[model samples]
Target: MPESPGLDELRVLAHPVRLRILSLLTGAAMSAAEAARELGETQANVSYHLRRLHEAGLLHVVEEVRIRGGLAKRYRHDPESGSRFMSTDPREGQLLLATMAEELKRRSEFRVQGKGGLTADAEMWVDRETWAKALAHAHELSELLHRAAKPPRTRGTIPVSTTVAMFEMRRP
Candidate 1:
């Protein structure tokens, strides 16, 4: 399996722009200009963040196209590159989680607005064995979805955003 993001990568990605850019790149390869259009920012501003992401090794060039006599570089996020991050320093870890949570909330809110995605969570009590069994099942479902989820190989492909988490609630 691919290794998770380290401290340096986490530090670099702490910027909100980088995280947003990474999300756009995840579903498809795009040029800086294309990403700017998606984010409604200047191409130069998007390019700056894209450079930072590439430097952090989270993105890579997949193709280049000649446009208006200039070369446009398209970059794609490494699907296997660091999906998680943790730090021995508590503050740093909290910061990482905070940033990640903000991005996730932003995405979820957009999906909610679109009116076709799922947004639900449940709280439950269970025995150790029951919890373990539920977790195993969740993992299995996630693996199945990951294998099937791709950027539409056919014309009828649908774009979807999904997030799943299950853990013991420690707070009310």
Candidate 2:
């Protein structure tokens, strides 16, 4: 297991490209060239982000193999127990919030283009005990999903941002 990453490390990963690279590696090891092709980016650009991610300790070079008489680096995501969602750096937090705002704007643009827009589905809950248990167990469910992948491989990393927020309604 790797050591938990700190706020600085998280900030290094907060970049859109770096986060996508990590997501791609989470399924299996990949070479920078392959990652670049998958992301529709140039190899040089992919290599840059790959180096940053490795420097942050979020990714590690698992192996170097000979390909076409040249060495190719294979990288994998190495998430540790200390990998919390919180960031100590204010700029990091601000960047994340800004990213969210940008995404909302993008989604709105899609709606204007006739794309199926966003929708909110809500339900009322009265059983605090049950809801709390469900919230706690949801983490376990996510872990299970992460660990349970068939073939456990991917062609490329897709940039995906997820926010799972659970909050109770205010008392009347």
Candidate 3:
């Protein structure tokens, strides 16, 4: 079987808090303190996770500035092409799967409390020749969407977080 890329980094990112942190900062940058406040967590707790993400190269310090007379550090997510996870062990795979489940739960819970349930529908077409073309098109479409969804030029802006989990398997 072909190995998934960035599996290890994905594992690190699978933590609910870490995933939340990334979602919170998507398309923009924020200070650790700001992230903590948005997540209803302590500054120290947010800092710890931010450090881990930075170490994994998933995030980086974008800027450091003084906000309201207090020195603060700002961060941005690292944009990388292809999968960043890098593990093959079954145990690690299980952990990655669990992390994804927890993240989904947290997001769903938040949505329910704020408004109601969210819904989405997807369709796929499968064929040896057409599948390759379709997959390539999807990749291009994703890049375009990412580029078009730029954050507004304002501070204290919270973005809507969306997670896309893709799994594909084939039998011969």
Q: Which candidate is the best by TM-score?
A: 3
Residue range 123-159, candidate 2, lDDT tens digits: 6766989888977876775566456422123345332
Q: Candidates' lDDT values, in order?
A: 0.72, 0.64, 0.68
Candidate 3 per-residue C-alpha lDDT over 1-172 given as tens digits, one digit per residue, 9 for 90 to 100: 4356455556666688987776556566888887888889999999999898888777888899988998788888744522446456556666767877777766665463555444554655466677677667766766665554544445664344455544344344
| Location of the lowest summed lDDT over 10 successive residues in candidate 3 | 78-87
* Candidate 1 global lDDT: 0.72
Off by over 4 Å in 1: 1-8, 83-86, 113-159, 164-172
Leading candidate by lDDT: 1
TM-score, one value per model: 0.67, 0.63, 0.68
Task: Show pairs that collide, candidate 2.
Answer: none
| 101: Cα error in model 1, Å | 2.3
Error of 3 at 31 (Å): 1.0
